[model samples]
Target: MDRTDADGLFPRWIAHRGAGKLAPENTLAAFELGWRLGWRAFECDVKLSADGVPFLLHDATLERTTNGHGAAGARTWDELARLDAGGWHSPAYAGEPLLRLDRLAEWALPRGAWLNLEIKPSPGTEAATGAAMARAVEALWRAHGAGESGGPAWPLLTSFQPAALQAAQAAAPHLPLGLLLDHLWPGCWAVARGLGCVAVVLNHGLWTAALLAEQRAAGWRTLTYTVNDATRAEALLGWGLDGLITDRVDALGPGQPATA
Candidate 1:
């Protein structure tokens, strides 16, 4: 898919984080685990390090997800990189390095995996994080020649924060964006159109056959997140869900099932 085309902005299925439930979430090991399972597309969160480089992390604080204890953005990549990011998940994954977005892009591009980069800023850094991440993505896209003079699929960026979405659009107007909404909002379609979003990602709870039909009928691609149950996933697929972000990529088929 060309970077300019929204038609192929997403993949059939997205592993929640590298391997979702199969490995420690958001670590390089987990991503590789997903790759091992024949999955090419995955979703991961990106947050700015203290020096503004984008790095993979799912929380504002590193305590819960990694052995490190502190605000993720408060520490420079050099400092955060030294901490054990995978030990808490299990002894088998003690030294998983913090994944730089640039490195992840390098790794994923060769294998043709579509990335869904969720911009998750620290509490007050929405605009900054959004702008920074957008700039970073733009630079990477340009460097990789992901523009019209392209090679492979550029990542699809999404976020629940409108400010972040706006910033991303401004930073790289050409890069496709998606609106991540947890519920049906008033004029939600209008909002997504205004932001130039290529897709609408809903919280798993609010999804239904009716809503899916409504969005699909309107020519909008719809996706759900964090779904882990096989039966529910099958049901969503039957309802014509465009895609899913799941954790159990290794246990499921090629698309990888949802993560909890």
Candidate 2:
């Protein structure tokens, strides 16, 4: 899809951080679980290692998600790669390896999965993280032949950090971008517009019918994050909200989410 397509290039139900707490967040197991649950599109967090290699991870620290200690970005890829990213969630997922960004692309593209790659950088390393991720994905997709001719869906890059988005745009202008918001502050639209973003991913509570229509008129797709309630999901889709990034794949009937 064209990077400028305002009609949007996302599935209606996007798996939040890949099935969201269903498996372990940001691990390959989580993504595979989402795909098995029949979700065509998945969202995930990405950050650069100390050596500049891109990898899947959500927090800036390793304690909550992995069997490691200290700052996540401070660790080299070799160190991060050895960490068991899944055991913290449950014993069933013990020994699941940390997923490299390229490794994920390899797995998902073959399975015909779509992605929302959230550029989650650690403090002060946002610029480098974004640039590296953009470069890595460019190489990844190009090798797989993603375009009008048919291959994988174009991955959408998103982030809550302006520096990361800015660096990504500079590095790979053709990739689709989304600006994630905890709240849509006064300057959020301008920041999104300036970055040439296709969407604004907001906290699910922030959307209103008027706001959705207003953003639609402005040519920006509106997506919500981490929603798990069935009633809210129905309401958002009914409101013409472009996408729902959620954890509750089961909230919709089986085979419902992927088709929605």
Candidate 3:
């Protein structure tokens, strides 16, 4: 598939976990806050609940963001839904519930927001989680993609787990896939190529002009995450990097030409 068109699918500056520290991460409130701050693109993480429902969340446990305890993947959607996802952030957001991926799709479908969905599988359920998440994404777009019901742009599916990315590829090859790397390693390029990924997301420290050139030379786009400083963001953009996922949605508004 010629996925070069996917290059134009995103902006240079993406809101990290939906406005990052501005609101409770991965909650609808966060995404809403990002939207209010002029973010047109966002990055998020997703995992399967005990009952196999896909939901937006980053950690393996719910203690950090929710009022619930124990492993997040150990609970059903109903049980997870009962948790207070925003109270831990502040009493101002006391009643936020676990955000389901489908519900998120519903919000984005009509709004034209671009999402970079990170396939964050639980420790032992990598393949299952990836397959399930991909299926849900495909179903959502099929029901809402452009010219069908006039949906927003389709999302880009990316992951750090090879098994997860592989399963997503097997389940939905038409969706743009990106391989994520926490650290640079030997044969990393081969791993991404093997999975048929069109892009590669890396930790900010791994970004370099040479690295960007190498990826470009091999016909792939390079993006980095959690960048919060202006100097580093400028340096990376100067290096010809494709995108920077940042927590500072406040500082890096979407109105700028680079972000536009």
lDDT to native, each model:
0.82, 0.85, 0.85
**For each candidate, what TM-score against the reference?**
0.91, 0.94, 0.94
- Residue-wise C-alpha lDDT for candidate 3, range 1-260, written one tens digit per residue: 10113447556778898878989999999999999888878899999999999999999998898988999999999999999999999999999888999999888767878889999988999999999988998898788864354455668889999899999989988788899999978888899999998899999998888888889789887888988888888888878777789999888646654443
- For residues 1-260, write the lDDT of model 2, one tens digit per residue: 11112354877778888877789888889888887877778899999899998998889999999999999999999999899988988999999988999999989888778889999999999889888888888889988988658766679999999899999999999998999999767888999999999889989999888988899899988888877888888788778887778888666523664334
Check candidate 1 and list the clashing pairs: 18-31, 246-258, 246-259, 247-258, 247-259
What is residue 176's positional error in candidate 3, in angstroms? Answer: 0.8
How would you encode candidate 1's per-residue C-alpha lDDT over 59-139 as one tens digit per residue? Answer: 899998788887999999899889888888888998887899998888887766788999998888998998999898888
Q: Once model 1 is optimally superposed onto the true structure by TM-score, how far is the C-alpha of residue 225 displaced, in angstroms?
A: 0.6
RMSD of each: 3.4, 2.8, 3.1
Ordered by TM-score, highest first, the candidates read 2, 3, 1
